[model samples]
Target: MRERRTIIDAGWILLLLIWSVTILFPLIWVFYESLRTNQEFFQDVWKLPSELKWSNYRKAWEAYGIGRAMLNTVYYVGASLAIGTFLTAINAYVLTRLEFRGRKLVWGLIMLSLFLPGINALVPQYILMRDLHLTNSLTGLVILDSLSESAFYLMMLAGFIQSLPKELEESASIDGASIFQTFFRIIMPLSTAGIVTVAIFKFLGLYNSFLGPFIYLSDPKKYTIGVAMYQANMIMQYKTDWVTLFAGLVITMVPLVLMYIFLQRSIMEGATMGAVKG
Candidate 1:
């Protein structure tokens, strides 16, 4: 039995290594390619660069407008992350912790969206944005993103909130604390793991969102990193500056990767502890 378990563990480790390589290879190759000149890349795709051309990143930032797009993404993502996290936390706390009429009905209605495909709502959302004259605005995008709650996140947060002891709320109430006070002071701080997890998810999704920004914003100045990279692809058809594009891709991925690396502990704890009710 011991020998069999050891073999099974080894098999799992080997499978994990393969998966890691599959994910990391593209990122490493892109960073490698980003250091090469376009001439070197086209001459021999497999050969290492004789001299690193770090200027590709500068060119990507200045000529291709990646820097501006990154800035746009930061503001778009930051604003929505703040709004969405706060709103979702409060909503989850209310639904799970507070007693009120139609709570289950409201939750059911929200969860109903999870059953339907998101593509079905795109046309209607576009029309609403256009009608509101919000199609070309970043603020409009922020508002839309903040209000559009994810059922999965809501459920995760609700689970976390439900697991909290009611004794805390009762104690807070004995001291004449209001619902708002209890939530802001006690519940919010205690639910840090779940909130951080949700924020990271929101941040990553908003930063990488392409279709919404593509459809809503026509102006180049308003483009997010995803849309900017897409525009770079279209321009590359004529110019073929692969190295610069590679640099731009690396630049786009770095911040999010670093964020996930730092917060992965919180994310793991939240996902595990929230599910283990007993």
Candidate 2:
């Protein structure tokens, strides 16, 4: 029996190792290659660099004009996460806690939208942006991403809010607090887990967003990391300076990787708890 248990543990460990390698090997390879010069790439792509090219990062940063791109990305990500999370929380609060007419139909409509392909709306969205002269603007991008995310987050947060014990709200309300005060000061604080989960999701999407910026922002100066990376690859006519490209790629992914690593536990617990409606 002990032998069998040991064997089972070994099997699980081996499977986990394989999964880790599958996820991490690409990132490791990128790091290795990013330190190599263009000459080294042709000589032996697999070989280690004679000396690490730390300056590859600086060159990539300047060449891609990633300073401006990063700023734009931060604005887009920060605004979308802030606005989207707020709207989703309020939407979920109303749907789960408050009495309202046509609520079921409203929820049904939102669920139906989840099945619709986002691509189907792109052409129409572009046309609307053109008509409104919102293309090439930061505010337009933030609004678009915020509205784009409403349905999914609303459903996720609604499930979490519905699972909370009603007694808590009742007890708070009995203390002479208005409904707004109860929600803002009491319920919203308890719902932080769900909010953080949705915020992380929005941050990932908005930070790495490609399609929206690619279509909307024609101005090179306003490009995000996604667009800037694409241009870096394209400028060399598809044979991009591999070292610089890889360095830029690493820089682009590092912040998000660190963010997830730091917040991963909260993200997982919140997401799971949010979905587990009683």
Candidate 3:
């Protein structure tokens, strides 16, 4: 049994090593490619860059309007992430804590929506947004996403809220704390790990969201990072500036990488933890 366990552990470690290389190689390759001039890239696609042409990043930023698109992404992603996470937390709190009629039914509906592919609502959502004159406006995108319901995250946060001790609520109420006060001051604070986990997930989703932004936002100034990257791809067909495109992608990816690196410990630790105390 000991020998078998050792073999299994070794195999797992080997697999993980391979997986890490598989993921890291492309990012390293792209960083090198971004530093190469178009001439050097064509000369040898895999060769080390003789000189790092940092100007590629500048050109990509100015020519592709990635700077503007990045700012737009900041607004679009920030507003949506904040509103969505708060609303999700509130919904989770209510669903788990407050007793009401048809609660199970509402939860069931949410579960049903979770199973439903979001693509099914694509056409109708576009029509609604277009009719409301929301298309091509970043503010419109913010409003639309902020109000949109996501049942998946609802369930994620609900589990954490539900795991919390009822005694906390009881203790707050005994001190004459109102429901809102108990929730905001006690529940919200206790559910910090879970809330942070949810916020991180929401931020990642909002940052990478492509189709909705592409379909609704028509103006160049309003383009998110995803849409701007797509536009860069379109430009590549006409003018093959691969190095600059790679630089833009590298720029887009660095922040996300840093964010995940900083919060990775939280994600791992938060998943199994709750506010419960003995």
lDDT of 3 by residue, 158-206 (tens): 8888888899999999999998999999989998988888888888889
How high is each candidate's TM-score?
Answer: 0.97, 0.94, 0.95
lDDT of 1 by residue, 1-278 (tens): 99999999999999999999999998899999999999999999889899999998998998778878988998999999999999999999999998899998999898898899999999999999989999999999999999998998898888888888999999999999999999999999988888887887888789889988998889999899999999998998799899999999999999988988888887788778777841
Index of the highest-lDDT prediction: 1
Off by over 4 Å in 3: 274-278
Error of 1 at 164 (Å): 0.3
lDDT tens digits by residue: candidate 2, 1-278: 99999999999999999999999999999999999999998899898889999999999999999888999888888888888888888888888898789988988988898889889999999999899999998889888887775687788888888888889889987888888887898779989998899888878877878999999999998898899999998887856588998999999998899998899999989988876762
- The count of residue-pair clashes in candidate 1 stands at 0
Q: By the lDDT metric, which is better: model 2 or model 3?
A: 3
Distance from true position, residue 273, model 3, in Å?
A: 2.1
**What lDDT would each prediction earn against the true structure?**
0.90, 0.87, 0.89
Superposition TM-score, candidate 2 onto the true structure: 0.94
Model 1, position 160, has a per-residue lDDT of: 86
* Model 3 residue 95 CA deviation in Å: 0.6
The C-alpha stretches of model 1 lying farther than 4 A from their native spots are: none
